[model samples]
Target: MKFLIAFLAVVAVALAGPIDERGAQIVKYTNDHQGISGYNVEVETSNGIRTIEQAELRNLGNDNAAIVVRGSYSYTGDDGQVYTVNYIADENGFQPEAAHLPRA
Candidate 1:
């Protein structure tokens, strides 16, 4: 039991990874009111991170009404490569697409 516990402890520490000491600052940001129905947002960070999203009300004032969201985000990975993901969430479900993702 002790050996198992110590093994698990070691695995946890290895998986946790080292904390980054650097700080990221927001370099750009924008929020726009697209009327009473929805809004749009965009942001960029000094540390090579960016995201944009838009939301709109669907089926307004109905029992099945929902807010549909569409968005994309990009960030620099540890390997120094930029990764971007585009996504949408609506009546069906959340779908994300990116070059790195495997084909279904």
Candidate 2:
């Protein structure tokens, strides 16, 4: 049992790969008055880092553009289990804390 536990621990650590303590966070500055309206953006926020996956361009209204962001973050929670956090661009702005705002 001891050997098995040790092996499993090593395997888990190896699979985790460096353990990204700092996750990803993305912020989008969208202009809804442009040719694109439905802009899709991907963002991931976890641990202490932020990652931007992909940003899509779309047109929802006349000469308007909205930024749509999507992404995922991986981190080890307090329970010692790997957890993934899914995030999206709520609104379009460069505010310091605009990412947490509610989306329309």
Candidate 3:
């Protein structure tokens, strides 16, 4: 009875942690192939703030991967523009497009 209780406790503890399969794959690819696989950031300043809500890495096979980031930013200024951007990074480099990117 005591052994059974201890085993159940250990199993419950193990199940309490979140599992991230995609993140594990990204780490594996990064370490094995020296590839850029993921990104996450959030920053705030007096004038502006930005947050990266989701960033993921997709394996394209052949040791290649693609990084996709979804984020939003706001500026506390006269324009007071707020918008979201989706970015992709791969062999071609980073490509980011924003629906409300400020134009000069």
Q: Give TM-scores for every candidate, taking all chains together and pairing residue i with residue i.
A: 0.73, 0.35, 0.37
Per-residue CA lDDT of model 3 for 1-104, tens digit only, reads: 99999999999999775453344221111112234655556555432444444466777555776665555544343454455566655557766777665544
Q: Show model 1 residue runs off by greater than 4 Å.
A: 1-22, 34-36
lDDT of each: 0.91, 0.51, 0.54
lDDT of 1 by residue, 1-104 (tens): 99999999999998777536377789999999888698899999887889999999999988999889999999888776899999999998999999999979
Best TM-score among the predictions, by candidate number = 1
Candidate with better lDDT, 1 vs 2? 1
Q: State, as a TM-score between 0 and 1, how close model 2 is to the true structure.
A: 0.35
Two-way lDDT contest, 1 vs 3, winner = 1
Worst 10 residues of 1 by lDDT: 15-24
Candidate 2 ranges beyond 4 A from true positions: 1-52, 60-62, 90-104
How well is each residue in 1-104 modelled by candidate 2, as lDDT tens digits? 99999999999989876655445344433233333334333333444333434445546554665666555545455667665555556456432223334666
